[model samples]
Every structure is written in structure tokens, then in C-alpha cells.
Target: MNELLVRSGGLYTTVQDTGRFGYYHMGMPPSGAMDVYSAVVANMLVGNPDDAGVLEGTYVGPRLEFTDDRMVAVTGADVPVTVNGESVEPWTAMRVGAGDVLEFAMIRSGCRVYVAVSGGIDVPVYLGSRSTYTLTGIGGHQGRKLVDDETLPLGAAGGRARGGAAVPEALRPALDVPAELRTVVGLCSYRLTEGALASFLGTDWKVTKDADRVGYRLRGGSLDFTEREQPFGAGSDPANVVDLGYPVGSIQVPGGDEPIVLLNDAVTGGGYATIGTVISVDRDRIAQTKTGDAVRFTSVDLDTALAARRDRRERIERVRREIAR
Candidate 1:
């Protein structure tokens, strides 16, 4: 069978597609590529479906040897990629033969890198997705991060993939600048004092080491909550409220100090009072941010949020047209 022999599974490597849906009510978050735009572009470069399974490597990247000829593309992080010790440009599709080894250098900017192989990663799909949710161990390869010396199956490659297909520089997401996350200030936001809300938006929060697929914990300025009697079933902490469902991009400030931006693999519901939600498209910006990176939240209206999503869709469509040429 066609396969990739994992020489080293980097820091945290896993298989992920678009995401799993219809299970959030069961407390499962849609575990997928943190930078969906990058992941999709990687797949497109190799002529795979937009939601095709790809390898997501965090901080570091995996070393793998191909067992058959395949088309490959790497995206997301600004990391150096090498094929059999020779450097190669990222965001471009390249052909690899059996015995070809692929490797990555230390990340220069973004936290995660996506590798898309032609025919996609052939792992058993659970709940309509190949995403890995490591917390409960449900999907991906063995429901956890890939380990050293493991073998991953690959699907049959399609004939349409063209080597040397590259995404234009303008279309690629920028990794050099601090992230400015557009947020919709609403959900339970009344809990915060006026000064606290302003602080949350104005401060240049730094991403803490606790940032991951589940959530990104940030530290910058402290916030103050308006005093109120603790409601029944709610914890004594001022940031606590009776359990409420958390959207994928919700921001929750625990202890009125650090704010956690919940991501693809975050909990479905929690007692923490969510101050606002980062717009969907901006989640890609936050995903590329590494520890110590600065980020600021900008409050925007719902119409603006929807417009951003539309713009992203158009961008992806442009990529599709470009790669087809």
C-alpha cells in the first residue's frame, strides 16, 4: 500500500481535514486545521479537495519518506522546507518519488505548518472528518499526535495535480506582523466594566505558552468585572457565569486577567463568561501567531464580520482558478 514513513513526528503532528460537524452538542469541538486558509491552499496546490486530509505540524515539522510517487505542497508557517536535503519553496506543488525524504527547518514566524500530499492522508474518518481531536482521542491517526517511525496511508492520487503550481505571494497570508483580531463585542460582555472593555481592546496582548488548538491564552492588561451577586450554579469568580455554550472563536477571560480565545478543539460549553467572539476569518490570523506574539482585538459590527467571510471565500476561489491554469 502507498504510505509515508514517518522518520520523526516533530513536536505535535496530526492529520486534519476541514473539520467535524454535528457533534458539538455532545461537547466536541470541530477539530481541524487551525489556519484553514493555508490548509485549503495546500490541498488546492496538489489538486486535492478543499477538505482533503493533510498533515498539521505545530512549532516543528515531521520528517517523512514517501513510498510512492506523489504530489506534495507545504503551507501555513514560514518555515524552510527541504526535499532530500535540498531546500524547496513553500506554497508550491512538487513531485516526490518513492524513497524521497521531506523535512522542515525551525519555524521562522507562524506556529503551525500544513503539508498536503496528493490523494490526501488516507486515515479512517470518524464523524465525517479526518481531524484529530487529541483531548478525547477520537479521530486522526489513533486519535492522537503522530509519533516517530509511524506509517501513514495515502489515497490514490488524482491526475490533475501539476508540479510547480505556486500560489501568488499576494494571496498568501502574512506571518510577519502582529495579529489584529476583529471581534464582535456582545456575548456576556456586560459583565465587564467600561474601563475593562476598553482595556481588552486597547492593550497589545501577548500570546502565552498555554496557546494551543483548544485555546489561545493571552496576557497583557487586567480587566475588571462589574460587581454582582453570583448567580445559582455559577462559581464565585467574577468571570464565572452559569454554563453557556462557547462559539468556536469566543473569548473568555478567567480571573479577569488573562483572556483565552477558544479555537477548533475547545470545549463546547463552559462556566466562564465569554466577552466576545473573534470573527471567523480572523481565526486564521490568530492561529499563525506563536508564543510572545502581540495581538489586539478590534470591535466590528456583524455586517463587517460577514463581509470578511465573503472576502475570504472570494480569495479561495481565486486560488482555485489560478491553480487550474
Candidate 2:
């Protein structure tokens, strides 16, 4: 029964849930929290369900004023949080009430942050999710990022979290390091010469400013394509393949140069020749990296990818248990 008044919307804050599913065939991307691990942990701190809607802040954090009492937590980045100008810790549940203003200082590390309140953000669901797909204006708080003075409604509180509930140090994510993404290379990788594939893994790519919800563009050493005639339906560009469904987290190099990592909000199908896919768990790692950061992709097998998926689930369970203690 509380309202969150957006005093400031920071850089690009959006309401996100687990994500929209089962619609990629129609070209709809699942627009959700880019850093699923951070989003889920933030919710865990506040006793919200893993898929509950939370605010995803990019770089800068939003300034919000609570209109009623609620429990809140911030996660993902090493940013300073405050209530009524008083410093509060991230990864810990804190109580807030009417007139209490939550603000963020400069981002010390990490690119995005997740904010979870007692009650999830109660935006109207679109396609079975409360995620915001800003490109086409669907779902979330009016299908866009929060702006100054916009009030967000909250549902019934889901947790009995009390103040001082802190996430264990080992359970929290860290930000100040080179980001590494585990990738499964194969689809259309034949387009790249053997040396190019090696270079792709050996190089440390720099994230470009053009990176956004849709996908991340990286600049590194050029990758060379193997000589071959274009396929029947494939485009003329060496990097082009027949238009096909892009698996979430797939990476495609255009002109055998910069690689693009498709994310949650990216087009489901494209003509680009995807050379690999970052494993599900490492998507969380790359999500924390901002423009100008160094990223290295390590090749892994499907077995390794599956193991990583399990490891991520186990880690989340660990957080849940620690919070329940």
C-alpha cells in the first residue's frame, strides 16, 4: 500500500522481473533485469520472490522517496546508498517509512544496481511479465524507465524482513576486476578461420559505449573469416548468415571485427553469423561491466555450461538460506 516517488531517475532505471518468455518467435525480446543474479539477491534480502519486480539502475542510482513504511535493499554494484541523507549498506535489508528519501552516491564499482522493496513493484503485467521492453514501449512502469516525479505502486509486502538483515560477505558479488564470460563457441563459427577463433578467445575486448539492453558491442583484434561462397539464403556479407533465431547470449562478429553479445532485450532473430554464446551464469558477470571495461571470453563446453547453471542455482539457494537464518 505504499508508493515510491521517483525524485530522480538516475541514468536509466527500469522495473524488471524474471523476464518475458515464449515470445521470441514473434521477435519479442525478454526485457528483464540484465543482472539476474543481482536482481534475485536484492529480492532475497527484502524477502521478495526471486522473480519479483525490482528496479534496475544503470550506472547512476535512482532517488526514491517512500510514501509508506517498507523494507528495502540495494544490490549488484558497490554504490553508496542512503535514506534521508543517512548512509546505508547495500546487500542489507533496511526499513524505510514515509518521507524517507533513498539516494545513491557515485558508483564506486559495477555498472548496474538492483533495488528491491518489501512489496514488488506492482506494474501491469505484459506477456506474463512485469519487465520493461523500452524499445517498443511495453510492460513495466509505462514501458519506460522511471523519470523524475513518477510514482511507482507497490503490492502487498512479501517479506517480514527486519532492519539489519545483511547478506554474508561471501554471498555478495564483487565489481572491481576484469570481467570474464564463459562462452560456448560453435554456431556459424566455421565462418571464422581457425586463427580468428583463437584470437577471439585470446584477446581482451573493450566494451563500447553503444552497449545497451539490446546487446553489447566489443572492440578488439579483428577476426578473419574463412573463404567460402555465401549460402543460398545467407546475405552477401561474410559475417551474414541466413536469418535465424538468435539464442540468448549469442555473440556475433560483424565484418569479422567487433563482436556483439546479444542480451535479454536483443532481437530474437537476425542474419548475423553467431560464433558463440556466453554461458547463462556469466551473463551476470558481463552485466556488471560498463563501457570501457575489459572483458575476456573463455571457451567452454556444453557440459561446463550446464555445470555453471547448477552452480548459480546453488549460490542463490545459499543466499536464501543465509537470509532465513
Candidate 3:
């Protein structure tokens, strides 16, 4: 039961696990790590379970001091991580002794970074998750991002870990600009004119400053709805429909101009018409994209979405096998 002392809590650092699931119907969004792949891979590197809680950092990373010897790994963003100011490689497991300082440099690319220790963050689990939903202050350290001088508890490590455990080059995600996101087009897409739906797939949308764990609002795309009188109870706005459940990763155009892709901590349901959903696997890709990054959506069928899921699972299995080597 060692502790992790926070030296400088970098920009928006919070504890996250796989996610809080099955609570969306009550308007509680799953608050979890945005880049699921990176988070899981990081835990794997440290020989922890896939759902172990890790630190999620945006733009900057927190500086931490370990209270005891532990294994650690950094993943997601290609940022420089240092041990007591000495450079270390990322995407690989390393050992930290008691009183060792871990710090991160500015993000070189990508947005979120995951710091996984051998023992997961030991915050009391609520609703079966240790993830922090900061909007409502539900889980994690006070349901908020870490602050300077904060101390985080660590769970007991389930197994041993060796330093230098690495995820091979090919297995890493491409955080390339103009990330192409696979979307399953259906939902309430019927409300949009054929030309408008085409415009959505055809345009390269830019992530706006409004992007966050809740949702990503994109600019550079406008959708025109087919002419129709407002339905009973639906709002007068053309973008509005009967308030319905918004699937995680669902896309909605509020003003018919800015299209928002809901993410991990997004609201559960709203009156806005949802065009489609970014396939679950592609959500990992979108998570890495920062404000100002270019994004394009490509329509995919249910089968394609399923195939992508299988591919991701297989890749993860491969990483597990590699770590065992």
C-alpha cells in the first residue's frame, strides 16, 4: 500500500480505468481513459490487468514520486518521459525505486498520455470503476484532476514486472494528422439530406478547442436537414429530434454547423439528431487527436465495425504474447 506523491500535476491529469459501463441510461457517462489501446498496453507492460487504473494526462504530464519500488510505463503520446530528469524511452516498462521522481515533457504529438504503474491507482471503486468523471465529481481523487502536492494511493501489484518490456513498433497506433475515423452511418441519419451526409464523409473536419473527454466538436462541416415540420415534442431546431439515447461515440450536429462526436464522459441522451457513431475501435484513434487536428469520417457497415473490433482484440492478444516473451 505505497503512495504516489504528486509533485506537479500537469495539465488535467486524472485517474482512469477501462471505464464505468452500464450507467449511461441514467445519464451517467462512462468516465474512463480516452485512448483505450494506449492505456491497456501500458498496463500490460507493467504486468497489470488490462483494466488497471492509470493516470490520464492531457497536453502535459504529472510529475510523480514513488513511495516504494514499483514498475511503470508510459504510453499514448510520443512525449519524453524522464526519471529524475534523465531521459527514458516510452512504451516500455521501467523500474522506479522509493523517492524516484518521474516527469514528462511537453507533448511532442498526440493529446492524452497514460502512466501505468505495476499497482493500479487505489481509489475506492464506485459503480465498478476507478475512473474519474470530473463533471459530476463521482470517482477517482475527489472526482477531479490531480493538483500539485496531491498524493494518490496505489493498489498492491498482482504480479511481478521486468523492466524493458516493450510493445513492438508495428503494434503502436498512428497518431498521424487528418486521422480517418471509421463511422457506422445509421441512427437518425435519415433526417439529413443525401448531399449533407455525403458532405460529412467528404469533408475533413478540424477538431475545435471545445474538444475534451465529454465530446469533440469539429468545424468545417455543415449539414442540411431535409425539409420537415417539427415533430411533436421535438425541439424547433432542425437538428433536434425526440430526445433519445446517445450511443458512446455518436455524432450529433447541434446547429447543423458544428458536428460533435461524443466521447467517454459525454452526456447520455439529448434532443439532437445523431448522424452515426464512430466505431468502437476508431474511438481510440479519435482519442489521440488533439484540438486543431484534422479528422475525416468514413462510413462503415456493422460487419466492418465487427471486423475492426476483432482486429483490435487480436492485436491486443499479440501484445500479451509479446510481453510474455
Candidate 4:
């Protein structure tokens, strides 16, 4: 069997696929690639299935030595990639011989970087996914971030990918600018005063150090909740509501100061009142943002959100066509 030797597992690196579904009701988040678009694109560039398991690296990245020939692609963050100490272009397929070492430099912009090989990472799948949910120690390689000197198994190569096949600059996500997340403002929005809602939208929020796969805590402006008698079964906190399901991407302000946007690894339910939900597609935008980055939310209707999803699907299709050539 083919294997990848980890020379240095920089920061946090995990194996992830599309995501595990049909289990969210049991208190498990999908725990998939945070930047789904980049992960999918990297898989495509390497001729792997869209859901093939890939490596997701946090602020820093990993170094690996290949045990066999393979085609590899890197995407997501704007980070420098090198093979055996020589630079290679990202968002493009590159060939590596047996013994070739892959490395990454400090991130230039985005938070996470994705590396997809021609053959998917062959970690044992659990609950219908290869994704790592580190909180519970299930799935992925031992259900945690990679450590140096660990060996990972790789599946057989698909043989369709060619070195130098590239994703066009126009199709790649722009990481240099502040993210403007399109949100469907509703749910418990009635709990906030009009001015508070306005402030929530108007403020340019900065991502806090608390940002992670579970949620992004942002700080900027304070919001005021409408006064109401605490309901039975609800906590005394003004932001508290009866415990309810939290849809991924839902925004909840626990203290009227920091708004947390829940992501793929967030809790399934909580008592906090969710003021809105960032649209599914825009979650990709937020995933690339790092600590200290600025982001703003734009209110939109459900129709607009669906349209944005369609646009992203079309873009992925375009990428498929482009890489096939």
C-alpha cells in the first residue's frame, strides 16, 4: 500500500472529505473541510472524486515525503508551496516522484490550506465519512491533528490528472480583501432592537482569537436586546432562548458584544438566540478569514441565498470543465 510520511505536521492538520451527514441530530457536526470550495477544487485538480479525503491544514501547514509517484494540488489559503525546496504554483496539479518532499511556507493571507493528492487519503471512514471530529476522537487519522513522523495511507491514483493543469485566476477565490458575508437575517432577530440590528449589520466585525472550526467569535459593536421576562426553561441571560437546534452558519450573540457564527464543528443545539444565518455559500468566504481579519454581514432574503448557491454550483461546474481540458 502507498504511504505518506509526515516529516513535520505544522500546526493542525487533519484528513477530511465532503462531510458526514444523517447524524447531526445525534449532536455531531459534519466536521468536513471548512473551505469546501477549495477542497473540492483541489480534488478536481488531482482527478479525485469531489468527496475524496484531502488534507486540511490550519494557519501553518505540514511537510510530507511521498512513498510513490503521485499528482498533487494545493488550494484554499494563499500559501507558498514547495517540492524538495523548490517553489511550485498553487491551484495547479504537480507531479511528484517517490521520495519527493512537499512543504509549505507561512500563509500569505487565508487561514486554511488544502492539499489533495491524485489518490485520496485512505484513512478509515467512520459514520460514512473520513472527516476528523477531534472533539470526540472519531474518524480521520486517529481522530486528531497529525503529529510529526506519522505515516498516512493513500489510495490508488485515478490516473487522469496531469501536471501543470491549473485553475484559472478568475475562478479562484480572492483572499486579500475583507469578507462580506451574505446573511439571511431572521430566526430570533425579533429579540434585538432595531438599532441593535442595524449595528450588527453596520459594524465591521473583527475575528477574535476564539475563531476555530466550531465557530468564529467576532467583536466590534455592542447590540441591545429587547427587554422581556425570562421565559420558563430559558436561562436568565438576555440572549438566552429555549434550547433549540443550531443550523450551521447561524449567528448567535451570547453577550450582545461578540457574535459567534457557528460552523461545521459547532454544537448542534444551544440556548442562545440566533439572530440570523450566514448563507451556506458564504460560509466558504468566512472560512478563509483569519484572526484579526475584518468581516461585514449583508442582509438578504432566502431567494438571494438560493441564487448564490446556484452561482457557486455553476462555478464548480466551470472548474470541472476547465480541469478536464
lDDT of predicted model 3: 0.93
How would you encode candidate 3's per-residue C-alpha lDDT over 29-104 as one tens digit per residue? 9989999999999999998999989999999899999988799999998899999999998999998899899999
User: What is the alpha-carbon lDDT for the whole of candidate 2?
Assistant: 0.90
Please list the residue runs of candidate 2 whose C-alpha ends up more than 4 Å from where it truly belongs after superposition. none
All candidates' TM-scores? 0.99, 0.98, 0.98, 0.99
How much is the lDDT of residue 93 in candidate 1?
Answer: 96
Off by over 4 Å in 3: none
Query: What does candidate 4's lDDT look like per residue over 270-304, in tens digits?
Result: 89999999999989899999999999999999999
Cα displacement (angstroms), candidate 1, residue 298, comes to 0.4
Candidate 1 versus the native: TM-score?
A: 0.99
lDDT of 2 by residue, 31-121 (tens): 8999999999888888888899999999889999998888999999888888888888999999888899999999888899999998889
